[model samples]
Target: MNDVMWKRSLALFAVALLLVLGGCGQLTNSSSTASTGTTSNRKVQTTGNYSTTGYNSVVTEGHYKTSAARGVAADYANNALDVKGMETGLMQLSQDVFSPNKYTFQEGQYISAANVKNWLGRKSKSNATGLNPEANGSTDPDKRVPEYLGTMVEQDYMTGSGSKLSLGGISIALGMNAVDYYQKEQYGATFQTKVNKDKQLQEGKTMAQEIVDRLRAKNNVGNVPIFVTIYSLAEQDSLVSGSFIAKATATGKTIDKWDSVDQQSGVLPTVNNQKPINSADATAFNNFKTQVQNFFPNLSGVTASVHYLDGALTQMTVNIQTQFYGQTEIMSFTNYVASVANKLLPGNAPIQIIVSSVNTTQALITRNSGEKEFTTNVLQNY
Candidate 1:
C-alpha cells in the first residue's frame, strides 16, 4: 500500500482500537435484527483479532475508505488530538449497542469526500442539500458566521461471519463546533462564534434528523438501526476533548426518541486548580503525575484526559511531555512511569500513558481493563 492508503488504514485501526472491550460471538437482539436483507444459518464467529475483553471481532480486511481518514483532518477540529478523540469516541459509543463481538466493523462507505464538503457548505442556490445556514454575503468576521456543523462521521457495522456478512447497523456522529473561531482576513484578528452547550445540543439534533433523512434515501442503508450521536467539539487550543451530548436510534427513516448521554471528559491534575470529577481516580492520577514529574524534574508537563460514561470512569489517556532526549534516560523514565501507573492508577478501566519529547512520541505504556500491569514500548530513533 502507498503512504496515503497506509495512513488511512492506521486511522481506521485507531478508531477500532478504542472499541475493544472484554467477551465473544453472542449477538444482541437489536443486532440480530440489523441484517440488511441477508439471511444465514451460520452462527457468528470470530474471523479477526480478539479484543482485550477476549471478544473476537469479524474483520473486514480490504474494506477501508481513504476519504474517511482525510475527512477527520479536513472536517474535524484542527488539533490532531481532537480529531482522534472525535472519531474514536464515536466508535466507543457505537460499541454500546453493536458489541464488537457481534458486529464486523468497517469505515463509512456511503459518505464520500465530496459529499462531506457539500453537506458542510452553506445552503445556497447551487447547494441544495447543504446542512449549514446561508452566508447571506456577510463580510464581517462575526457576521459571516462560522460553520456549526463541522463534520459528519459514519461507522458501518456488519453481522454474521465469513463472506456473507451484511449490514447490522450504522452509526453517525455529528461533530459540531461549540466555539467557531474565524478571522476576518489572512493573518488578521480572530473572532469566535460561541454557541452554548444547550444550543449546540439542539442544533446537533436538528442536523442529525436531517442527515438520517438523507441516508434513508441511500439504497444500502435500508431499515437497519441507525444510531445518530451529537458531539460538541472543544476549542482548538484545549488539551481536553469534547463530549457526546445525546444519541438516538433511527429504526425507520426518522428518529422517534432521543436519549441524553451522560458522557464527559476532563483534563487531569485539574485545570485552573479546580476540583476533580471522581476523587479516587483523580487522586490516583495526581499521585502518578507527581511521582513521574519528580523523578525527572526536566519534564515539561504531565496531563491526562479522563473519560466517563454514565458517571463511571471508562478510559484515561495520559500525556507526559519532557525535554530529555537521551535514549537511556527515556528508557528509564518509561519504565518508571509504567511502574507508577501500574501501582497508582485505577485498574478497572483502560489506561494509555504516552511519553513524548518536543513533538515526537518517545515511549508508550498501556494497560487494558482488568489487567494488573501495563505493556511498555520505547520507540527507537531511525
Candidate 2:
C-alpha cells in the first residue's frame, strides 16, 4: 500500500477505538451496563430529613397469668416506659398514641354486644373478655388466647422481667383500650375519680416486684431484668414539668405533692441500681448514626429530636433523623428513643425490631372525601 493510504487507515482505526471506549464508560444516554446507574445503593442520607416510613399500625394480644400480672403489664405499658420490655414499651406506645375504639357511645346510650365484638374482638356469642378490661366490661378471660388484629408490622420489646408469671398462662393479649366503667372513672391520671395516685404507684411497684419475685421463684426469666412501669398521667406530666414523683397511687386518694427539679434533666444519676440503663440508652442513640455510618455510607443527614424532662433518667429520650437521597422518612421517634432506651435499662439486652418504610398516612389522602376516619388509642391501666 502507498504511505498516504497507510496513514489514512491508521487514523480511521484510532477514531474507531476512541468511539468504542467512550460508549462503554458513558453513564448517561447510553444503552449499556455502565449507563444503568443504581439508585438504591446510591442513596445519600441527610440528617433531619424523612422518607415517610409509611402509615402502619400494629395490634398485639397479650396474656397474663393472674390479675396481678395485669398490673405488671400495666406499668410496663405506660409511665415506666423506661423499662426495657420490647413488647410492653413499643406496643403500649402504639396503642396509647393511636387508640382504636370498638364503638362510640352517645350520651345516655349503652354499647351493643354486636358493636362490642367488632370493637374489642370478643366473639359476639361468647362474653367479651381478655381483649381489654377498659373495652369489654364484665367479660374476664378464663385462660384463653385473645384474638389479635391491627396494622401489618409491630414491635417486640422483649423482656426477662416476669415472663413466666406474666407470659405464663394464656392471658389473651388484646391491645384495645375502650372506655369502660373502670376506664371512665380514672383513665391514666394519677387521681382518677377518688383513687389515691400515690397509693396506686406503690401498688404497681409492689405488683412488679411481686411478679418478678414469683417469676424468679418459678425460674421463668432467669437473670433478665424486668422493669415494670405503670402509667398515671399526673405522675408523668409532673416529671416533664421538672418534678419527681415521690409517690403516687390509684385507689382514688390524694398523693404527696412533688416539687419540680427544673435544672437537672436526667443529667445526674438517681437510681442506685447496677448499670445506668437510662443514661446508656441516651448515649447509644446520640451516637447511633455514627455506628451505622459505615454500613450505609450514602447518608446525607438524620431526622427527629430528643427532649429531656426533669430529674429522672426514666424521662430522658434521644430523637434521630435519618435522611437518604431526596426522600425523607420518619419511622418513630419513640421507637429509636426506646430502642436506645432499652440498652440502658436493667434488662438482659436491648429490644429487637424489623423496621420498614411506610409512606401513606391519612393526611396524605384525598382531602375532599366526605367520610369520617376511625380514631383509636390504646391505654394500659394495670
Candidate 3:
C-alpha cells in the first residue's frame, strides 16, 4: 500500500494485558488436543518494541479470575497509558531475568481470578484469604486500612523448545494504589488518601513475599524462579502513569532480596514545571510540536509521554491533535510530522507519533529502537 493509503495495524498483541484486564474467564488448555508429554510448538506472532518466545494457544476462553478487577484497572488507573505501561513494564522487567530469547511466554495459568479476588479483599472473618489489613471502625479513611493492593497480574515464562515446554519462571506485577479514594458515607463526597512512595514500597514488599509463597504452594510451581514487581498507580486525574518502584526475585519459599527500579514516565511540556522532566527530551518534543503546529495552523494540541529507564530515555509516544477533516490535509500533516520527528527526536529509543482528529486516529509513525528511518501510515476514512 502507498504511504498515504497505508492503514496502520495494532501495535502490540498484549496477550498478558488482555488476559488480565479482560477478566480471563474459563480457558481451555492446548494440551487437550496435544499428545502426552508435549504441547504445541506454535509461537504466536506479535509486533511493536518487544517479542515473545512461544505460547500455549488457548482453545476456549472465559472471564478474568475476578471480573470486578478488570473494571478496577479501567476505573482506578490514571488513564489508558497507565494501564498499558503497567502491563508492558512488567514484561520488560521479566526480560531482565527470564531472557525473552531463552524463554517462552504464557498468560498466567496458576493464579486464578478467585485467588486474586480473595487476595484483594479486606482481612475479615468471612474470607480468610484476604491480603489487605482488616478495616478499622474509624470514621476517617486514613485510619481504616487502605486498600493498598489493587490488582495482581501474572505472566509465565517457559523453557525447552519443540513440543516439550516447561514453566521456567513466573513474573507478577502488583498494582498498588497511589491515592486511595473512598466515601465516608454511601452518598457522601469521595475522600482521597495519598499513599507515599515509602508506604507503597513497604506494602508492596510484604505483599510480594506473601504472593510468592502462595504461588509456591501450587503444584509444579515450587522451586521455579518468580519475579515480583510493584507498580504505583497514578491518581485519577494525573495525565501520566505511575512507575515501578521496586522488584524482587524469589527462588525457594522465601524472597531473599529486593532491588530498586529507577523507571518512570511523564507527560511532555510540563505544567508549570510541577514534575521533574528530562530537559533534552522536553526540548526536542517542544521543537517537534512547534514545527508541526506551525505547519498546520488548524491543529488543536500536541502532547507526549516520555518513558525513562535507569535515567536514560527509553521510549516516547507523541500525540498530535488536529481539526482538519480532509484526507489531503491529514496526509500532508502526517508527512511533515514524520519528517520533524526524524530530524529532532532522540535516535536511541523507539518513538511512536500518533496523529488524530477529534474522533479517530488519522496516521501513525513508528521508529524502532536504534533505527533512523520511520515507518508512516495514514489511515483512510471510509
Cα-based lDDT for every prediction: 0.71, 0.26, 0.70
Name the top lDDT candidate.
Answer: 1
Q: lDDT ranking from best to worst? A: 1, 3, 2
Summarize candidate 1's per-residue lDDT along 63-129 as a digit string, tens digits.
2223354454355564445565666677778877788767777667777777787887778889988
**Which regions of candidate 3 deviate over 4 angstroms?**
1-80
Candidate 2 residue lDDT tens string, 1-382: 3445333333332233234323431111212111111223432111110011111111112211112233333342322222222222223232322221211001100122232334333334554332322223422342222222110111212211211112111101222211111232445422222224454344334433433344344333344322233332222222221112221111112222322222222321222342433565545544654554444454332221122224322222211212322222222232333344344322322121111112111011000112132111111212
With candidate 1 superimposed using the best TM-score fit, by how many Å does residue 348's alpha carbon deviate from the native? 0.7
Where's the lowest-lDDT run of ten residues in candidate 3?
5-14
TM-score of every candidate relative to the true structure = 0.80, 0.22, 0.83
Give each prediction's root-mean-square deviation over alpha carbons: 8.0, 25.8, 7.5
lDDT of 2 at 212: 37
Clashes of 3: 9
Alpha carbon lDDT at 279, candidate 3: 85
lDDT for residue 326 in candidate 3, whole number 0-100: 90
Error of 1 at 97 (Å): 2.1
Highest TM-score scorer: 3
